[model samples]
Target: MITSMREHKGHLYPGGISNKRIGVYELPDADISKYQRPWRAA
Candidate 1:
């Protein structure tokens, strides 16, 4: 779910579920476009 959220920037915003449940696991502010590998696309 974390990967998927990061993929599309779908629903993983500040108030999203991941933030609610996993309070310590914040996503990094990465440049999604810089990822070249398929698995690292997001």
Candidate 2:
């Protein structure tokens, strides 16, 4: 359930969920390219 802000002209904006519920949620339609990796010491 990718929810977003619906403007007058039907504009959708991806947002975050506060106190995210387990049953209902929406995956933002955005770039999640960033990832977590172990730190490498030089």
Candidate 3:
């Protein structure tokens, strides 16, 4: 199992996940645009 999260437009958004048994994969990078929130540290 896998889980991840990201911030976009000042809201917490779900990030993508991939599972492969016979292939290679990479985790997606976090989105930076409009990710800054007033209640969280930068």
Local distance difference test, each candidate: 0.41, 0.39, 0.47
The regions of model 2 sitting more than 4 angstroms off are 1-21, 38-42
User: Which numbered prediction scores highest in TM-score against the true structure?
Assistant: 3
For 1-42, candidate 2 gives per-residue lDDT tens digits of: 544442222233444466353232344554334534533557
Candidate 2, residue 7: CA error in Å?
A: 24
Return the top candidate by lDDT: 3
lDDT for position 4 in model 2: 48
* lDDT for position 16 in model 2: 45
Alpha-carbon error at 9 in model 2, in Å?
Answer: 29
Looking at candidate 2, the ten consecutive residues that score lowest on lDDT are 5-14
Off by over 4 Å in 3: 15-42
Write out the backbone clash pairs for model 3: none
State every prediction's TM-score relative to the real structure: 0.20, 0.18, 0.27
lDDT of 1 by residue, 1-42 (tens): 443233433223323545444223334674566655565534
RMSD, model 2, all Cα superposed? 12.1
